[model samples]
Target: MRIAVLMTNTDESDFSNSWPKDGEKFPAMMRRVRPEWEYVVYSVKDGVFPEVLTGIEGVLITGSPHSVNSGDAWVERLFGLIREIYAAGIPMFGACFGHQAIAKALGGDVAANPKGWVFGLVEKRFADGRSLPLYASHSEQVTKMPKGAEVIASGPDCDVAGFVMGRGVMTTQYHPEMEPAFIAALVEHLADELPSDVTERARASLVKEADMQAMAERIALFIEGQSA
Candidate 1:
């Protein structure tokens, strides 16, 4: 499959080579999921070419520092593009900001959580255990489920963790692409902002350490199951 990974942030200072640290971490995860597939990385922060998506088999929209609800023209444009992609019935998987974008595009709401942030690997109870092994570290969660979206997974903080609309459009609020070591790096970076309790909770959820191969296998199964 020709999969395009979209990078939405323009913060050059965020990490080395102008890519988010998690973006760099995900390819290793992808290799284990579909070794034969070609995965290309694109920066919407640079600009998006709608033509690049024509023959693509799948699109995985990565998390961003920016919110989908931001009053940016580019955000609106990307949402429009995603709407087109979704309409074409191409498989799309969105994480974090990508999930928020999916929510916004589908006539849902995105706002700061009144409960504030939920940072760590939260114990999410799925309606069915189809969405196990979720890894997330974010403050805002989707409170209201979008129209025609399935609430596959949920937790105390967010009622919407996983959602599938139509045939192949799917999203997860969790970061299956992020592992413990990666989250450790993020934790260190956000030390001041992250509470001690949150960090401890994340560490408790660590299994298999930072084995990208295993995480990739789990993610691959999840994606393939979506196709089935």
Candidate 2:
């Protein structure tokens, strides 16, 4: 499958060797789920994207450091592009920033969590009685949903941790692309951006192996238009 990976942010400046760029992270994790998938990455934060979505069967939007409400020109352009993709009936999957972006662009609301940053590993509970501990690192969440949006799963702190729109789009506020070690490294990288106590808890929550396989398969299922 040929997938368009819309990478919304660059890697942290201080830690070059500790981890890969945000764009690299997704493909690495996704290849385990769909090894045949070929990715074409666009740096959305740097204003890079295809002129059109022609021939792209699936679209994957990566997490970013920017907020969905930031109103940057690139973000505006991306919102418009998302509409185009949806209009064309292409399947799309979104991660952290992508989740909030998809929600906001589709007429939902995103805001700071009243409970504060929900960093580290979190158990997201699905309506079907299944729970998965996935890596999370976000302060904002989709509060009000857009038309046709359905919440499939949620966490204690973030209600709309996972959602879907029709069969064409699926999103999660957690990072399926991020491994536990990477989350720990990122916790240190983003120490100044969050409270020290939050960072400390995030550090403590790195014990579990991230339940990434199921989430990765979920994205692949959504992209391939199959049952979840």
Candidate 3:
């Protein structure tokens, strides 16, 4: 099986010294979860999309610093691609920015979170009512839900923390692929932009452990299960 990863982040947001780009990081993370599958990346922000969706059994779109409302041409183009992927009936998974993108493409709206940036250790509630603390990093969130979106997970600040759409489409607001070190470096990179109090709380929460492997496995199961 093969999965195409649509990388949306162009620059590393000044974290070059310590963290790898999303494209470089996703494959390594996914491979650890499902080593048998082939993973190919495309720079979607650079307007590179899969010319041929045929034979691409599954898909994963990574998070980005860019917002769904950025009005960048590439983001618009990706919205079209998301629809195509869903129509094509391929199992799809989205992370962070990718989650918001999917929502917007499907008729939802995104706006700046009034509660401000959500950075680290949020307890996300699934539709069934189970909750777990996961690393989080975003200022904006989904304000209005899209038509037909089944919200599977939510946060107090981010109502649509995770959801499942039509045709095996699964998405989450947090980065299942990000390591603790990567999150730390990201916090440092955007400290100047993020509010001081937000960073302080985020840093304090970082001392606690997050099960990166477990998150990876959950995502893997959603993708690999598509084969059956």
Candidate 4:
């Protein structure tokens, strides 16, 4: 599969520089499931995008530190590109901020969590009764589902933890690309920004293993036109 990875992260901190970028992080996780797949990355945060989508088989939007509601020019352009991609009937998957952006771009709503930030490992319960542990790091969520979108997963803090629109689009509020060690490092990096209790709890949650491979397989299946 040839996929277009839209990297939306804009962090320039020392921690960000020390770690693998979203472009690298996402492909690393995905290549585990589809070793033969090829990825083309675009730093959409910097206003970079493909001039045409002629050969792109799939699109994957990575998480970003910026919010979808930020009203930036590049964000608006990305939304326009998302609509164009949907109109062209290409399969797309988005994580975290990407998730919120897809929802908002498709006539849904996103807002700050009433209960505040939901960080660390979280268990998402699907309607099929399957639960998966995934790492989360976001302050906002999809408060309203887009028309025709189905809620596939939910968690205690987020009602729309994951959703799907037809066969071509899927999104998740959590970060499956993020591993335990990465989340640990992220929590430490944000120690001064996050609440003490939240940081402590996030640290405590790392002991539980995340279902990264399972989520990756599910995403891969969806993008490949199979039931995920």
Candidate 5:
């Protein structure tokens, strides 16, 4: 499958240099399940996007530090592209900021989390009663579901941890592409920015393994138009 990745991360901190680029994280994780797939990345944060959508089987939007409500020109353009993709019946998946963007673009709402920042690993209970642990690092969330969207997962801290719109679009408020080591490093790197208690608890939660492989497989299946 040929997937177009819209990378929106704009972090240039020293910490980012120690890890793989944001554009590479999703492909690295998805490759475990789809090694034969091809991925092309566009730095949407810098106003870059695919010139043509022909032959693109799927589009994956990566997490970003920027908020969807930032009102930047590129952000608005990305939203327009999202609408175009949806209208064309192309499969799309989003994570974190990408999740919020999808919701807002589809007539939903997003706002700051009333319960405060949800960092580290969180156990999400799905509508089908399946529970899975996933890494989270966000202060904002989707406050309203768009028309025709179904809430797939929810947690105590986040009402809409995951959602799906029809068979073409899926989103997660948490980061399944993030590994334990990467999240651990991120927690420490942003220790000064976040509350000390949050960092401490995030560190403690790392002891339990996240269901990354399972989530990765599910994403691959969804992108392939199979039962996920």
Candidate 6:
């Protein structure tokens, strides 16, 4: 089994390159999860997705600085690929922009987040108490779930933090792979792009290293379970 992570460059002209960019964060986190499947990074900016994703066991799309609603041609193309992957019965997991894209691809809407942006660690309620390692580094969130979606997580600020669609696809508004060091680096790197107040809170959350590890283990299980 193999997991292909669809990555688009965060520095795309329209978006802000705040959080470590797709290249840095996605690879490092995939290593930590150690999905039973070998992991491959398919860069959209480099024109690899349509070819690289072929024959892959499963797919994971990382968060991006760009918005799905931006109407970028690449985003539209990627959205089509996501639909194909879902129709093929392959499991797909999405984070941040990835999450938003998944939602939009499945007949949902993505917006600029009128409430501003959500940054730092948040306590997300898993109705089943199943959420692990809660962290986020985005300004946009999923307001309405995609058609026929079942929400798995929610919080005060965001109505939809995580959701499951069809049989094998899942998308989370929060960053399950985020660690203390990663979060620290992400916040420090994006101090300017992010709201001024959340910087301190983001740093404070990373202090709890154990929680981050526990969260990573949960995600690993979820990713591996797909192969099983």
Q: Rate the local accuracy (lDDT) of all candidates.
A: 0.69, 0.87, 0.82, 0.92, 0.91, 0.71
- Per-model TM-score on C-alpha atoms: 0.83, 0.95, 0.92, 0.98, 0.98, 0.83
How should the candidates be ordered by lDDT, best one leading?
4, 5, 2, 3, 6, 1
- How well is each residue in 46-151 modelled by candidate 5, as lDDT tens digits? 9899988899999999998889999999999999999999989899999999999999999899999987889999997888999989999999999989999999
- What stretches of model 6 exceed 4 Å from their correct place? 12-28, 33-36, 52-54, 210-217, 223-228
Best by lDDT: 4
lDDT of 5 at 176: 90
Clashes per candidate, residues 3 or more apart or on different chains: 0, 0, 0, 0, 0, 0
The whole-model C-alpha lDDT of candidate 5 against the native structure comes to 0.91
- Model 4 TM-score, 2 decimals: 0.98
Off by over 4 Å in 5: none
Choose the strongest candidate by TM-score: 4
Among residues 3 or more apart in sequence or in different chains, the pairs in candidate 6 whose N, CA or C atoms overlap within 3 Å are none
Q: Model 5: which residue pairs collide?
A: none
Q: Which of the two candidates, 1 or 6, achieves a greater TM-score against the reference?
A: 1
lDDT of 5 at 50: 90
Candidate 4 per-residue C-alpha lDDT over 45-110 given as tens digits, one digit per residue, 9 for 90 to 100: 998999999999999999988999999999999999999998899999999989999999998999
TM-score comparison, 3 vs 6, better candidate: 3
CA shift of 146, model 2, Å = 0.4
- Cα deviation of 195 in candidate 4 (Å)? 1.1
Off by over 4 Å in 4: none
Q: Superposing all C-alpha atoms, what RMSD in Å does each candidate have to the true structure? A: 3.0, 1.4, 2.0, 0.7, 0.9, 3.5
* Candidate 3 structure lDDT: 0.82
